[model samples]
Target chain A: MPFEVYTFRSSGKRLFAGKNTPHFHAVYGIIAHKQTIMQDIQTEMRNRAKELLESKQAGLVVGFTLDEYGKPTPAFITDPDDVGRLVWNDDCVRSRHNLVGCLKRDEVRKLGKPAVVVNAAGKRAFNVLIAESQREPGDVVLIDMEPEPRDARFDERYAKLAMLDTMSREERFAFWKKEFTRCFKCYACRQVCPLCYCTQCIVDKNRPQRIDTSATLKGNFAWNITRAFHLAGRCVGCGACSAACPAGIDLDLLNLSLARAGETHFDGYRAGENPDTLPIIGTFSVEDKETFIR
Target chain B: MPQIITRQQLLALIDSLLEAGTKVATPVARGEKAFFQYLEKGDAPLIDPAVFPVNSTKEFFFPRHEILYTFERQGTEVLVTDARPFVAPQVVLGARPCDAAALPLMDRVFGWDFQDRFYQSRRENTTVVSLACAAPDAGCFCTSVDLSPETQAGADAELLPIDDDTFEVRVFTEKGRILFGGKTSESDKTGRTGAAPDRKFDAAQIRERLQTAFETPAFFSEAAVRCLGCGACTYVCPTCHCFDMVDEGSVDKGRKVKNWDSCQFALFTHHASGHNPRHDQGERQRQRVLHKFSIYPEKFGVLLCTGCGNCVRGCVDGLGIRPVLEEIAK
Candidate 1:
């Protein structure tokens, strides 16, 4: 034994309590008492995963599994009977990443049809992919994370950005510089993001390299700014970029800044909302205000 | 030399090190997590024995971006200058033993066929002072790879906590001895280190499977599917040293710099002729497992990993070496 470590299992009962009780309690839902709700979600997840695989609706079901820490990890279920591996819970980062984005990966695509978790962010991601002809809606079977879809995450994402709105550009630059310095250029933000499904990212290009690939503060600043600007109107407000960042950077704030600009600055535009409509960026408005250019 | 030091004395020593212009690197609290970073004066070392910093200690030795050399062209002659061949003295305090153990494994490669002067310089100048772990998380598997919480493989000094305020210090190298010559006092009470974590997998079995099972791709069959192909795991890994060299400035005055690279990148093996030997993420993941268990071990007579679980903690979904090893061993 490793000197009594805390362990939280799928069962609601306590497994092992160690010195880090308060921390484990906070993470493991001992405080929330969410057993009943989580159990229901688990059953639904297994059932949906099983049905998708059995009915040939999906060859794979991308769901959740509890890791060694009792935190959610990705469970890619290819066998219907193996849906037993799946777990379900709230307070988890959605599907370990963007579900819509996973469909584009060659490994996942090789598995045939994939059913993936879709929360508020995922639906928008799916919608954006559809509009851009990146994926077909029929190809994916969505596992809705909420009983009633709410934009709580979306509201919180932009709500935090209101402080940035009040700050001068210099203060804002300082704030982001402090955050960007922590980035190791791991690209977790890009990997987890559904909208960032390009075969070749701009930073990876070698011929006449557009951005400095070094993890210097200046390089990070340019990369982050370019990343935000590129998704000016196409981000789905998933918050996965922020969730997946190991450096603990507020990447959501950067994306939300662009999300806000897409709405308030560009004629109330939002991405991944509707597949039939055109996006704000690619579509030009001749009668538009060009005052910001000055 | 004294053999015991109170927490206050340790803190004062850190201040002294900083005062003497020696770079002090320690795990410092960054938001909810602690990260191993070079500390400025007055910056407190986390000192929490249980907390594993969000990053490994490798970056302090082999940084993310370093100038290999600078070049200036004049007519037919080119003047080349090596950058930062000698590093200032530094101390790494509160490193996880697993992180410390990795230094020896890395030293093998860094000093192999071609000596990496950049890594060698930093390694020579830094003294590793590792903290014995008392509360390892479930993913930690030091025992599985022949390491323990207090393993002294790469540490210049070891600090075993006797209580909330004192540690039983043991020095291994001259650098460590010089750093703490008289700072500690002998104490009758010695600190106890945690027993090795429960062995998670059979290393010999996993290594054999990796050596023979290239066609099957057995263990990481579908698990690698969930991989986001991000550098998080490799970057956090203490022994995963892959880098790319690129010229920064224009032709006239450019510096050749080496930037950290990961095998998980889509273009890591993409040849100019458009052939990628590691065709997919699954193959790339297979390469990682093979290198750690089969390839490197065969060449060097030691496993390339320290079982720190940083890859698991840092990965997008906690799918790292342990899971694959455990599955293959089964």
Candidate 2:
């Protein structure tokens, strides 16, 4: 009943070879082309497989090749020489869909059937495959996809958005006001938002009626602004709130504006990346930059 | 001339209106507790004009639990059906100035970016009749905020109690005028003498007091340690607008509903990866204050509070905002 993991890799001829292919080959294996290259790849995969097998790390190894149309072919090789062609490349293996597609091929499936462990990416590959056709945690599962970098930035657009650094106070206020005025207080933005989920809101507190309940222009303005400020640097820009608002308010603008300000004011700190990182207002650093503070 | 009824006569008129097929909702006493309830033809004994109700009029416009849309699936295919729309037109009577003032604030959020047809439809059809405060409570601080006891900013028709029984009705909008149906007389006088002499406090002095309180060293330090992190304050607040969206039932068939949410809960900022951004109560409390005092004022020209004192009355731990504001003002 334990979960099992399976790893897979491609064993096709190189249609295009570059830095990624070399990087991939360094970890997985080289394309089975010249005898020398094939021998080198075989030596590497064997060294890796031997290390795992000796340590009782992985249960199986599955290697594959591709057809002329870039589709996974039915040909596979467990032999170290053939397995040597399975190299890792960033560009070639960047997508999960591509790896999954190649693994589902008939020839690859056969190789994967008995594999209790898979080393799909070649570098630090581990996944468990159970005997009952299930998956386990320790089983090494591999696919022909590029491995994530240590400090990779997921969205480059956020970087670009963070670079604008030229918005004035008036411009920022106007932008936020236009967006906030459209709020309907349906709380869809707050509900779908991962950041705004509090058990009891201060606005709802009756002890002093901190915020009014009768949804008005003034009240909505206060509520929306307060929400945006609380999420100032902490928003991950998931766009969940904007997507969920029944009022069609462009809340992303408010969040992004603050995010942009946070970047401009503070050395471009992003939220949700480091759990240990304190909020912008929570901690004060001696080397903190304060050009934006008036 | 149309009848100028006393308080009892007005109640009779409300009963007659209910008898004539109009849905009338007013603040009614249910034992010790009072809430806005449906006023039937013979519920005269239940109507209370003393204080603002425990519950808000938001339910009449937007119910706590409403089915936004329903989905039914046959095999792998799914069909989504919109829920029944809001159509009933009702009257909200005996609304306080703060509660009445809250309607426009709610409208901003609902009408901004997206138009909430359900809330809009109910709002467009309903008439709000508010009552002026005869005597203000120590906890009542609407005057300190952006409103006053007699402010009729959001009410369709404002009723000022002149004596023990009679009231001078002031119609503020066309809707209010229409609701009177040419029965009520109009007067040119801007101000009328009624109720207790209105206590006058300098808006500038109140603002100064608030400004001084915010500078007090204990304001943040005291609030940080005492708050138990419960949501009772936000839930009872006239302006709190946090909510949660949940899909009830099976994936094949279910309804997506939005329910009221509070920020005091630890899980409010919990991430899918088991990380919470606002993990501590102090941070949450700081967020509460900054949102109301600093951020809201910066975003909107007005402050978020109307000084209804609900939070003062509802706080279980005596960590009420008035003391906090007083500490801040000190």
Candidate 3:
């Protein structure tokens, strides 16, 4: 058989020939311009990281950069010269769960102070860290990310939670059971979670195993429900579990459902907010009223 | 005999399979994507040739967790009972060619020294009816792995969609003939075959490059630094067959179960003496690449990847195998 051939219009030639095709030029031109702006943001972020490291304001700066595959990923910058590796884009959300765990490390404490690059969502996790007395506000530098165009897909999942709620009990049960069957008990959801930073998880305790470690349907359900319950009043809705799940399970629904229920019943107390405010789960008052309890 | 079946007939075929006490599994469309699932009797099968199911059909053969045996302590004597595997006949309808091909590649490992009864039994009972992909994505590289959308490496039958409502079925085995009930018509055969897609990389070259690639620790570290040590890639993979065995239940009464495990996890290689040969993420990542491209190919004369692109698509970060292989080629 002869090798099938495809007509070639290389990117370089396309750029030059794009004038002949106005449609291609317009689309490609906008994309190229957007990329340039993104690169500028990344360059500025690197400069900021370098300044923080040089000024001794932060012994270590946690940032993100594109890897060899051009995938945005988290990076811990200690040397000023390495700051050029930092990047900022749509995919540059830092897992605050990792930062929370890092702050507790003895080596990190020995380094004097840590600065972290975070978006508005990540700042909520910092509030939880402060409220839990994990770190003092002054002990760390918080580089708040500028608001960019938000991806509506995540918010769309929250809306899908409503769709899930509309399902009958049997339908919901069947849906969750089918979803849980794909879970391999990888603990990636727990690993990626900023709030699930326990040195030893409950599932690891074999003496009186609270949840089975096997990836059986029953075991998966138990693991998922327990993990969700553990973060009921504290999950910052980072959507890390959903992103990390290889099975494409929308675990954000479970967390968002709890968050919605908490908001409705507990005077709209949100997790990852001002740490000074008493937590809904921990606080009790005679004024606390709920119709769902009855 | 090759035959043509309308989309409606395909659904009816699935219905008939279920009616005959056969478990027919296929990719089921949810909203935006599809998942491999068991189609109940009268349920419609959503075989989207464009979309690869999130979970592979590997679970149909080798389950995530299975009981090997159960033990009970009675009066000082321990009573052990071997759990028998269920060996019901099944059909996998409209599986991706890449996923179908993984079955035979995995067979080498499962059947090498000692035959895995559970996997073997499932393999023996199930007939794979793979659907050739109409459109391969940037992540898809079945051609690079010495397989293609129409390779039929592990399939008993192949279905080529000629249009939105029609498919040309090609039988490869007696099992496929049995499933179709010898109702095929030679006159209806289209004589059409799947077009060859663009090759992502050369398999021979990748295997050769993988030999000395392990020496470059700096390259591996740079490639794997973003890895969160997650099992998403492995779990979704059609060929990854690593398993961990653990006993569950009370100390007196328990069942030894095998669960899916991944080398990406730190605990997968952790030794009791606190020594791990694959200690860092980079080393672990290197092992994974080596296992698929070098070690498996050296032993089995076949690459351990079917190039379904699940590892690339399922990765939490954009840590893709295609790009990693490209780096090795460089």
Candidate 4:
């Protein structure tokens, strides 16, 4: 779908007269839901956008979409009558000038008054009455529409797997073993995982070949067990690893199994519940249960 | 009739193959430890048919620190440089069954939505020659993961140690047959035919045992408490595929690199905004178990563990998984 980009221009005054033009330059593109922008915002935005898109807001602009290499693409509007066609593109850019003209003319003719402006930034300084000043280029004009918050239930489901600690150990083990055996050892599970961003790995240390270099059954067992244990109570259950596994290994089962154990043994707790909280292992409480101690 | 090479002849074959332009890598003895090392003609060591290797074979396909794409910057302009293509076909000898199986698992991740050309290229060009296990370790349980010492899940050719000096080599793929120069002898082919040992416990029995173990407080409290939260097991595992991605250099210009990651570390799942989800050894321990037992199986319809027992031998605190499984099996 095409997106309309609106550049605000005030009547009787020029916003862009010279090289140092004061015109407001805003680009709008139809970003696909679940596409990333920057690391953080992109992650949240994609989750929200995907929800909106799935709910049938086909032409809605959930947020800005990024390119294949995860870079932001510039967008602009070129058509005035096609204002309604503005939709989100994952990383594609469109002209904004054309979109704004179409949106303004259409609203003025239909509503008999000023059109609605949607301000993504929600800046209070730009909250001016529609008719107060002639909208000019670079003017901090507001869009009069309110975009609903995007729902991220699917992505949320991934994050919520950390809470699946109610299952018994047998259930957990049966589940994870099948999942891990499918592992191809591709670093995608590590690459796409936000939690796996370490500077150096213990396995790569030359001082000791802590882990061996062959893909033998013994090696695979050691690696997967170590990985699962490492992520135990701390895993946020984003399921990014499971999603990223090319062999279709069920990485979430491993994360969830650990989450379940932590909850049962340590007062039913899981990871990622509080993004601001410390990991369970890093923090020790006086009331920490040590029943397992001999 | 295919030529039947004796163990001495096989070693000669390896030497000749190494001499014939291929880079041969095989398990070499380092003091008491064994690891895969590049061979120079006469130096390739014999395959260890009793134990599995500790490390994954990913480095051969995807090097630990590979230059994905190098770029040179010149005053607001940047020129991208392609990485050097891998030269020479390599043969991996003495790989275990579970190790061989791991290639396809890793292949799925590398060839997923975004194709990793470097990994694919190496996988395509290299030849893998695996060995069957003659003796299973105390912690070895490939049978539990639907694999056995004789399972040729992902091997091109499999070698069974018949005696100290003779090997029964079975070619499973076209690449292996070509490598063996179409060596096909009826006696050689029929000599190694045998079904894998029937694992005593069925899935239901295992599940029941695991369920009972989970119910008993001893399983979780006893084994998990001793874990020092070090990822020694993962670092040495062949199938554990977790990794971390980082960028080196300043924001002006840098390259993103991927490194191995272990869940045992406290900061593994920590957020950039100063929050960590898995903060405790217990939680981390739980994650380790679940990832292998539950989450991985849920997605892939198979257990992630190859049952090679590296984790059992690698852990410092003796928080090996075998005892835990044995308890669960009880």
Q: Score the docking of each candidate (DockQ).
A: 0.58, 0.01, 0.30, 0.01
Q: What docking grade applies to model 2?
A: incorrect
RMSD of 3: 9.6
Local lDDT at B65 for model 4: 46
Q: Write the per-residue lDDT of candidate 4 for residues A1-294, one digit (tens) a residue.
A: 012323222222222232212122222332331233212332333443343344433323312223222432212212233332333332222211111221222112232222222322121112111111223323322231223212235434345564445558797665555445434343445533434434455444434546543333444566667777776766655454554343445666666667667767766555543223346675556665675532
Writing each residue's lDDT as its tens digit, candidate 3 over B242-319 gives: 998888888799999988889887778877687888877778788888999999988999899988888877675656
Kindly indicate the candidate among 1 and 3 with the higher DockQ: 1
Model 3 lDDT, residue A139, Cα? 66
Q: Pick the candidate with the highest lDDT.
A: 1
Query: For each candidate, C-alpha RMSD in Å?
Result: 7.2, 27.3, 9.6, 26.1
Provide the lowest-lDDT 10-residue window in model 2 chain B.
B188-197
How good is the docking of model 2, as DockQ?
0.01
Lowest-lDDT window of 10 residues in candidate 1 chain B?
A: B215-224
Please give, for residues A1-294, the per-residue lDDT of candidate 2 as tens digits: 123322222444331254334445556655443434444444444566544444544333443333222422222334433444444333223322112212322223333332211123222111111211222333334421223223435345355444334667787666556445434354545643535545466664544545544344555777887888987876655554554443445567678778767867777675543334456664567766675542
Candidate 1 local lDDT, residue B68: 85
Best by TM-score: 1
Task: Report the error of model 3 at residue B89, Å.
Answer: 0.9
Docking class of 4: incorrect
Tell me, by DockQ, which candidate is best: 1
The candidate, 1 or 4, that scores higher on TM-score is: 1
TM-score of each: 0.91, 0.48, 0.80, 0.49
Residue by residue across B210-278, what tens digits does model 2's lDDT show? 444433344555564444455656766767766766665676776676656667666577776868777
